[model samples]
Target: MTDPARSTVDLFAPDVAAEPYPVYRELRDAGPVVYLEKLGAYALTRYVDVRSALRDWETFGSAEGTAFNPAMNQNVQGVILTAEPPEHGALRSALLERLRLSSVRELAAWIQESADAMVVPLVDKGEFDVVTELARPFPAKIVGELIGLPPELTERFVLGSDAVFAAMGPMNARTEQALGVIADVLTTIGGITAADLAPGSMGEALYRAAERGEIPPEHVVKLLWNYAGPAFDTTIHAISNLIWALARDPAQFDVLREDPDLVPNAVDEGLRYEPTIQIWGRFCRTDVSFDGVVLPGGSRVAVLFGAANRDERHYPEPDRFDVGRNARDHLAFGYGMHRCTGASLAHLEIASVVRALTTRVRGLELGETRRHLNHTVRGFERLEVRLS
Candidate 1:
């Protein structure tokens, strides 16, 4: 297909955020790359192109910032989210050291225990808002324990995280407001010490890295910010989306209930079907030709995970919410060097919840659902359901 010269899309528009699948289809049909004029960024809609750009971090760099807004993108430099390699390698290593598969596996019992504790009480309630009751509260608590932050402070962390995700999108009332809140969260984080977190928690590990000079002391607080936004927000939304999916299709829940081994697949499928972070940005480091189009140096490119995950070329019946779908290759946790550091932990958390639901609840009756209008994160803010 010939690349369309003009595909102006206000990605942050309420209508688009409310229902983006249609726009995703339009962009994919347009060509390999669609120029979003209002946001001044090229959007990659096809699965192949999106995956290619994510893996090719050298040409499509992160150092210039991944935020859609030029200012936010520039401002986010130096942090793990924006730093390119050698630097990214060092920073990523420090994080992965603590979050490696073996390390995260040790927490499986803790995660299952947490899920059981929260879900057991609610199973008999017959009706509850999954978002606020389970999805929202559960992740905040788990992240709090993982990061060793006080339970009271974890509540504030959720609000701060919402803002951090918002700041990644185009500059507007929402992004501006979130920037202000993030400033305060940063200040609060700057004051944290090892004593502030749980013993042997990720937060303490970060401090140990700083003390050993593996990471600069100044970046310690910034690293804590990572646990707040990306770790908490994405998993919470993924869990919410998963429950909603199962509830919508009771037979799917039965599929898992009959074979609990499918819990992990359910998590992967949920992420693919409705990714939490719908889109992420990358900066072009130098002139690069891709899919018959040259992306000039310094141009911004938006990688639409939502669109890519739904690409029919990659996934058959892309819109179907099937628990058995092997979606491990999905870009929901991203790809390449910058793939999500806490992916193992997220999988454990989501799977634990899925296991608890399938094993405990006889049926899930979904009620009114309300989606949050996040320009970047696509998920529900409210999902009412009853367990019987």
Candidate 2:
């Protein structure tokens, strides 16, 4: 009905990506759908609008690709995040067979064991870099082993995963560099054979599915990329962010340490407070109206998860980080059918670290921290912490 509110916000700018909440709050306050002049896309910043868009896939479609740049969008075409309807469902089903809650729950013991192995020594040492020591290695090891990838390839996948998210933004020098990394990573993955994968691993299972005609033979590589890319990147940042949150407020850590039951609550709150994936792209298949704002057909939409998660209209004291808060409904994982398939495993991995930390570490002190700047995700590249 009315012209959509407009802003010249450059979300992918280094400064903005490092500290985006202020910009996010401004956008959320502007309107339900704010037209981003610089990005040439509409931003859905309110909790209600974002959730609705995610649920209504027909209108806010992912099929045309969800990346801001055309190159990245074209690259994601057949991947689960970009496929529509039947194809999307088929791919999701294959992924769910392994990622189902029941199957993920079975890995809880192994996850906790892995967490303990990683966290305990760091605690005993008094101080460590959370990113390098815990966050990066924990998921790289766990997910890599599960996927049957060689230990060396697992580390390389992390680089590719970061590059994938970085290249999701408008093409620029940063994106160009990321695209180069992605090309090399894809080339490496392309050379792998079934014999290279561990027997009974999820990667091997995908090959078997292709053999059975459950998924296309060619889809195997794309599927592996889909699984490997998001699997480690999101969880790595989440682990670091959660630890950063606790270190920032020792009182919350104490609260968590006292009631181990709140470990799940802490994970949800951490995701809600500092989501790993800050924003994701979508293409409007048709003119979509949110409240009074209209996004014309063919419009590019940026769903601001970070802003919506902290919408004051949705949560009391939205900016405060409370370990007791129940934020399971947060859009950090996205909503509806496209909700992250690895959510359960991510929860398990984050909770494992939280449980391990709360049980052994008495206090946390955050030291020097450097933010990891990517086009879509927010996290610390380096986080120093002292545990006592």
Candidate 3:
């Protein structure tokens, strides 16, 4: 038997965030559950353990703050991200009816336009801050246009998204800052009318669904808030992440350069390699035992997406960055009832830019990278790159 005194959260010490895989491997080998005193919860580290819990909401609840340890964060409530059951189903249906793959397809023209505007300007500069000038601004505009906001609102969406992601942690300084940003974003976004929204994007579609009595118009309040704030951070981070992967290893870059068709595979592999959102939490409604470890009822459990993606049991040679690794089953997007509703739209957007970059740029080099730290979407503050 293992030592009952030593715990596992130490493996997540500040420096450990810089490289979390070793800790994850140790935890997986130790057992399915590890009690983290700092975060005050049990953690599920292995593939089978986590997948089982995530799929069974009756046991692992979301309505009680999916990312906050119930033992720590006492104010957890049911947002669309945390709610389970008939409640989650209704809200999610309202969201997906508007965010369907068909609607995603319809937005292609707008996505193409937004992407083109960002790329064309830097083609000649040869050296530009990819995150600020490209990734940050590009998704900001895409989200703004979709929501039917004035130019000023889009500007806030950029800053507000930064804050919202940062606030998804302990009620620290980041939480305070994110709360202010979220308030401003909600005020700005909630002011939106049918006239303000674009005719065919997800934001506008939600308003339409409301008119049909699918969802009360007031619900559109959080709906649009989610559209701009939550979506932007993840997508922007993904963009910078993909570029980072290529810059780190030219063999991978060369692979994409040689065969543009490999861009999608490369993008998925990049997500698996460096998931910007490292960890998420859920509440356990009942005491459960797995692999001989027991977690008490109402305990919190954090599922480290980045660590789990790198789990050697599910992925062989997990450290290798192959553009053609066939990452079809990757969990970068959470699985089960809460699987990302925007999966299709996100795929199209990432795929489009990857294909475009592969076709156009002969050489892409990074000059400097700035990381914007958030509790959740921790990624680029600014990434400078030169394309030739």
**Span of ten consecutive residues with least summed lDDT in model 3:** 69-78
**Pick by TM-score: 1 or 2, better one:** 2
Range of the 10 consecutive residues with the lowest summed lDDT in candidate 1: 1-10
- Candidate with better lDDT, 1 vs 3: 1
lDDT of 1 by residue, 239-306 (tens): 99899889889999999999999889989999999999998988877866666776667788889999
For candidate 3, give the lDDT: 0.72
State the TM-score for model 2. Answer: 0.98
Best by lDDT: 2
lDDT by residue (1-388, candidate 2, tens digit) is 8778999989888888888899999999898889999999999999999999999999888888888888888888778998888888888888888898999999999999999998878887899999999999999998999899999999889999999999998989888899889999999998888888999999999888889887778878999998898888899999999999999999999998889999999999999999999989998888878887788888999999999999998999999999998899999999998999999999999999999999998988988999988888889889999887
Tell me how far the alpha carbon of residue 364 in candidate 1 is from the true structure, in angstroms, after superposition. Answer: 1.3
Per-residue CA lDDT of model 3 for 20-122, tens digit only, reads 6787777777666778767676777766677788888788877777655222233234357766678888878766775789878888777766676678768
Error of 2 at 377 (Å): 0.5
lDDT of every predicted structure (CA atoms): 0.85, 0.91, 0.72
Best by TM-score: 2
